[model samples]
Target: MNNVKSLNKWANAHTYLPVDVLRMALGVFLFMKGVYFVSNIQYLVDLISPIEKIGGGMFLLHYIAPAHLVGGILIFFGLLTRWAIIAQLPILICAIIINFMGFMHHQNLLLALLSLGVCVFFLIYGSGKNSADYFFKMEQ
Candidate 1:
């Protein structure tokens, strides 16, 4: 059918520059967050100490900081963009969960939501045409 053909065409279409820009913005934000966590590791450890008391919570906290740093760097350069987004997804979801649990400050809720949105967007659309992933012709 014509509709099906049109849909296929749309699906295969290259994304515009805005998508890349948004991806870069998210990458920078996540990178900075990682840097902040690393620089203030003691503070992060202290803040999460209570949650770490729960089973498996300490394991999650231990890996999240480094994951953020590595994922952010990969995303910023558009290298392995989809995989980077996938790697970051769990952290973003955990942030949403924490926020909903009233563990986050009211002002931080909006930031968490926004970051989640960006992560979801990149997860779905990928790095677009401007990324190293695309340049290297890696399949999305």
Candidate 2:
């Protein structure tokens, strides 16, 4: 009985609620963004503009959207947290560079950039406490 109690205490000693909140928030945001992109097909089409400049086109956009759609759901669930963050980084970076960098003059770009910035921060730091990464690292 004493050994069981000690093991339980050791397992939970490092658990933190704030980390879990952060992770959940990040996941929710990513999922929402994915849904928004899916609903706004034109927006995703515009996303391909950068690639278009390099000779790519709608084919790439179609492929990328499905990935984002799935990735968003993965992020929301805290499943494969690190990989989800990594997958979203490119899209976020492109948004920051293209929209936030003054490519367009309006509120839309600003909002997109702000959202992208949050995602970037989460990606760099992580989803927080209640995440696979956190517990996995604990085991290590």
Candidate 3:
């Protein structure tokens, strides 16, 4: 009986529940940020001008919003998480590139870089514990 109780306690300690919660939170946050950009189409449009003169256009902003929205949803729900992270990587990289190329200085570019770094962390580590990946692996 003592051994059984100890094993139960150990299992509880090793559970990945926290990781799943964190992953969902991050995904929801990113998703909402992206949705906000989409909802405020004008902001993206205005950004197009400055970026377009540097060879980018409104289309880029238009595309990014959807990617954020979709990626966020996927990551949040642990559905196709790997694919979602991979998809968003390009969008994040483009934001960094566009910011650097179009800005007068590097402040915005730095911000973009930071944002990209965060995304990269998620992409690499994933929602490790308690995530769909974890459950999926265990089931297999």
Candidate 4:
């Protein structure tokens, strides 16, 4: 759409090296989280257990880790950065909601909130100059 094109244009003009670094850091964090979930399946199970009563919880159990893994990689390389962030949005939102519904860990709540905020920022900011998306765009 026109809006997206305009936003991309704006992001490219505004982007700098530090923003690109932040995006990479975010990607690493999410990827590690995916690895954590995959390694400790039981922890992930317990994470969603309280919300099981909300329905569709089992689906989340299966969905979160893989989404994080794939989405994290896509985001790290800045390949389809917005799309990757869009995919991550639901998981991050659920993470925040889940924290409130259960035994509250301030650390987790804060981390989730911070990560969600950054994700939202990057969603608008795009990948910046030093990214696969920019490089690929140049090639085309």
Among these predicted structures, which one has the highest lDDT? 4
The C-alpha lDDT values of all candidates are 0.74, 0.63, 0.69, 0.89
What lDDT, from 0 to 1, does candidate 3 have? 0.69
Q: List, residue by residue over 16-79, the lDDT tens digit for candidate 2.
A: 7765565676666667766777799898777556557766566666655665677766665656
**lDDT per residue (tens digit) for residues 31-114 in model 3:** 887888878888767545555676556558767788888988888877767678888887767666666566544765675576
Candidate 3 contains a number of clashing pairs equal to 0
TM for every model, in the order presented, reads 0.80, 0.63, 0.67, 0.96
Give the winner by lDDT: 1 or 3. 1
Best-to-worst lDDT order: 4, 1, 3, 2
Ranked candidates (TM-score, high to low): 4, 1, 3, 2
After best superposition, candidate 1 residue 90: deviation in angstroms?
A: 1.2
- Tally clashes: model 1: 0
Worst 10 residues of 1 by lDDT: 3-12
| Structure candidate 1, residue pairs in collision | none
Q: How many steric clashes between backbone atoms does each model show?
A: 0, 2, 0, 0
lDDT score of residue 46 within candidate 1: 58
Per-residue error at 112 for model 3, in Å?
Answer: 2.6
Query: Which stretches in model 4 have alpha-carbon errors above 4 Å?
Result: none
Candidate 1: tens digits of C-alpha lDDT, residues 64-136: 7888888888898888877888888877776666666546666666877898888887766667667787667
Clash pairs for candidate 2: 19-129, 23-127
